[model samples]
Target: MDERVDDDITFRRLEILLAFMETGNLARAAERLGTSAVTVHRALHALETGTRCALFRNEGRNLHPTEAAQALAEVAREVLRTMAEGIRATREVAGYSADRIRIGSLYSLTSRTVPAVVTGMKIRKPELQTELVLGSNADLLQKLRDGGIDAALMAVPDAASDVESEPLFVDDIFFAAPVGSRYADLAEVDLAACANERFVSLSEGFVTYGGFLESFRVAGFSPDVVMKTDDIFSLMNLVGGGVGFTLLPGRVRGVMPQQVQLIALQPKYLMRQTIALNFLRSRERDPNLLALLAVCRMARAGLS
Candidate 1:
């Protein structure tokens, strides 16, 4: 390409030229592009001036494309089509799905929060497919950073430069036990009072596990762990089966089994987790993320 053409030519100019070629007049081209006729004429004039070529010839008030313009329009059409394909292919190679969004979340959120958000997202973008990936908070964050997932729904992690988050809601930590357990009858559990109680906890890396640790730390003692599971559902099952007591977030209350009960923790031992949407800061402006974020805001409005 010549330096003059390179300096003057642009995607927008090409699009306007193609529009004019198809419409046969400035007013119709502007209408097709949803722009003013003056703007369309100005863009064409600028394009002609920049290219330093005879792209158009005036016949009364109408302008006709010259031979050079005709040839350039042919190339422009192919250029735009090829560029479109290239953009799509490049995004896929980068693991950025245009029609589907892979979202990472904690297993616990699968019960309600994730379902609600996914449904809302579908309603907003009917053509979009959603894939849910369940994992611990640490795992989810790592997946997001690695581009294995588009976004994550989990407890807000500590501040990091590479990630940005939008907090949806805060969930308080509670003491969970089987229905007939002595602690089940308590109005609010005094964490220290249950220090000697056997517990089944989610293993490390889980957001709930972090809350469990923090609440216990505040209570001034460590929990007696009889088992450590990888998922919150299993830990809840263990507690429901009377295997041991465990700490859980209030969000899990909806999914607690008939055999299990959650008791509020005493104020002194209170712990809360801020659940949020986490994504790479660089992708915050992505169209897919924008749609996901809109639904998240809707979820937050109902949750908060």
Candidate 2:
């Protein structure tokens, strides 16, 4: 037998060989490779032909690797690991290294939600570095899509194909008002009831602001927003100072001063914003992404 080694054998053949060795059956190997059994068999045959050796032989329904296969399997594992490490190193050079997971979230979540989550993530993966960026959902989503951030905790935008979302929590929007205000006396005030009240609200780029607008639209009225700001803290400050009332999440209430009172919306058009962990679907399988996701899942469980 003339043994010839071809560099042109291709990574696909090596991958198929590895899959077959790991799975120990043609059908299962094909499934792992996302191909048909015939395709996997052909690739295996091509690998054997290129190497001038039998990699596997049928033992009843199971395919058992010959000595050559076992030897090649070790080489294949090392090659795959080296390839992965090379790719990771290259990504690091290009600044995509997963040494630090960049996280973006709304200002409201920064007070409690994000901090709690990060504390948990730190406990779980002490070596994993984290960078937390605070911004509105719209701003954070844009950052996430642009690769400025690896993931975000924010309200899900309208259907987007590029991003994957994992729901972390749902926060209810509350009607916040100054204490002893006319509306403050009511246990729950309807959207229509606040139609004439001066409002302090988030600017156009916020998810909560969108919900605020939607709630008013549903109630056959538009909010008379006297002031608009980018930060939830600013909005809360304004409300606390009696500049105007606003619709904010209950979580925001936790950080606000005592003067601001949160009341339930009547006929309760309860606007619940779902906070989700968002990441690019294209990078889902990257090892760094896997680690980040594991940390996030741990954080979510701890917070819950």
Candidate 3:
């Protein structure tokens, strides 16, 4: 892309482009943009002229944006959001608002680990503004790489290059089944015993699911899987509803209902996951990240 062409693109033009794509009619687009229809049309014309593309076609006095228009609008949304965040961060550092930090974590940790970490950070730095983002293991790690989040609290085996990680704590995996299931009567359940049972597990992209499969692999058997969900709660609900048994981390103890029973796996298949806090190595010196690290360390040490 030519720098001159890039320089010619403006937020106003992008806004008009997005508005037009969203509303599809010049009058409606102008209403949303708080500008005259003529002005909106002029902005659209300038955008197309600068980009040297025909962004739309006339369909009975209404402009129908081409496929290119939709694609550019999508890219424009990301660019505008990134710029807005950049400006917000600069303003925050300039003392217009409290210090902001973005922390990402796995959805399963939302019930326990994240609350503990965020509470500690607020108690220590009262003015620190924190955003807690929750997603699957892969999503959180990608956010860390994209600079969307400052740190990620997730399981090990992340294996993302250029990222620095520190172990926060260890949570053992347990076999979850419906209350009063045959396995619940036993203190410990062997993987071989469940070889005939159906399992409900999370889908791929989650480290917990990986560990669950690895445990079965180590036990030399593959249990029948009835369902695979994306949410940990959904997995638990399936188990509680007697859909099938699942494997979950010990941290879910607080949220698991009495209808769900967690049986300790046999020693040979006992899987423990190390939840770690990871950030870009380049962001090692960021004070907010350091503060989050410190809070996590203190919390982990206290639990120990």
Cα TM-score per model: 0.76, 0.72, 0.67
Off by over 4 Å in 3: 1-98
- In model 3, the Cα lDDT at residue 284 comes to 80
Query: lDDT for each of the candidates?
Result: 0.88, 0.81, 0.85
lDDT per residue for candidate 1 within 1-304, as digits (tens), equals 6644555678898999999999999999999999999988888887788778889999999999999889889999999999999998988755565788999999988888898899999899989989889899999988998888999998888877888899999888888989988875789988888877898899999988888888889889988899999978888899889899998888888888889999898998888888999998888778889999999998887775
TM-score-sorted candidate list, best first: 1, 2, 3
| Model 2: per-residue Cα lDDT over 1-304, one tens digit each | 9965686366788899898887878899999878999998888888788787787788776667899988987888888889989998877653364677788888888876788767766776677798888888878888888878888888887788999888777788888888888877887887875667889899998998998998888788887888999988888889989899888888776689888899998654888888778888887775656665676676675544
Q: When superposed on Cα atoms, how far off is each prediction in RMSD?
A: 4.1, 7.4, 16.0
Better of 1 and 2 by lDDT: 1
Worst 10 residues of 2 by lDDT: 91-100
**Least accurate 10 contiguous residues by lDDT in model 1:** 1-10
* Ten contiguous residues with the weakest lDDT in model 3: 91-100
Q: How close is candidate 2 to the true structure, as a TM-score?
A: 0.72
